[model samples]
Target: MKALVTVMPKAGVLDPQGKAIGHALSSLGFAGVADVRAGKVIELELAETDPAKAKAAAEEMARKLLANTVIESFRVEVV
Candidate 1:
């Protein structure tokens, strides 16, 4: 099984990198680009074969270390 975890800055958190990307896009002639939020994606290969188990494990990893609970949130998808 494979677990794909996506971690992103929570609402109200300062994302300087995201802001910078947005500015760059606007300068490059991308019109009407309002905002951009940066995030990270982690792909994990697991020994478990079941999707449910892989998803649960991925969620636990996110809660424990992948995401900073105070300022970030994570979503898990198993394939």
Candidate 2:
């Protein structure tokens, strides 16, 4: 099974990196860009074949180590 994990900062948290990216894009003349936020994607291959199992496992992984529970939120997708 394949799992995709997306981790992003929670709302209201200051994102310096994302702000920097937005500034860079504007300087590069990317047009009317209002806001930009940056996040990370993680791809994993699991031995579990069932979609439910894969999703559950990935969720655990995110809860435990993949995401910082306080500042970041994570979404798990099974493929």
Candidate 3:
């Protein structure tokens, strides 16, 4: 099975990296672009064959180690 985990900053969190990217984009003439939020995706290979089990495992990993629950949220997908 394969699992994909996406981690992103929650709404209302200060995202300096995202801000910098937005600024850079505007400087590069990409105008009217706003509210750019940055995030990451992680792919994992697992032995579990069931999609439900794989997803559950990935979600647990996100809650325990992949994301900071106070500032970020994560989504898990199994394939």
Candidate 4:
């Protein structure tokens, strides 16, 4: 099974990196770019073939090690 984990900052959190990117885009003449937030994506290949089990394990991994529950949120997709 293949698992895709996307980790992103929670709403209302300050993202200095994102802000810097937004500023750079504006300087490059990009218009209407109101905001930008940086996030991470992780792709994992698992030995398990069952979709339900793979998703559950991925969620556990996200909660335990891949993401900070307080400041980050993660979504798991199985393929």
Task: Please give each candidate's TM-score.
Answer: 0.95, 0.96, 0.95, 0.95
Model 4, 1-79: lDDT tens per residue? 9999999999998888899999999999999998999989899899999999999999999999999989998999998
- Per-residue lDDT tens digits of candidate 3, residues 1-79? 9999999999999999999999999989998896799989999999999899889999999999999999999999887
Top model number, lDDT: 4
Candidate 4: which stretches are off by over 4 Å?
Answer: none
Clashing pairs in 3: none
Check candidate 2 and list the clashing pairs. none
Q: Write the per-residue lDDT of candidate 1 for residues 1-79, one digit (tens) a residue.
A: 8899999999999999999999999989999988899999999999999888889999999999999989998999887
Among all windows of 10 consecutive residues in model 2, the one with the lowest summed lDDT is 31-40
> CA lDDT of each candidate?
0.93, 0.93, 0.93, 0.94
- TM-score, prediction 4: 0.95
The Cα error of candidate 3 at residue 70, in Å, is 0.7
Question: Over 4 Å off in model 3, which ranges?
Answer: none
Sort by TM-score, top down from the best:
2, 1, 3, 4
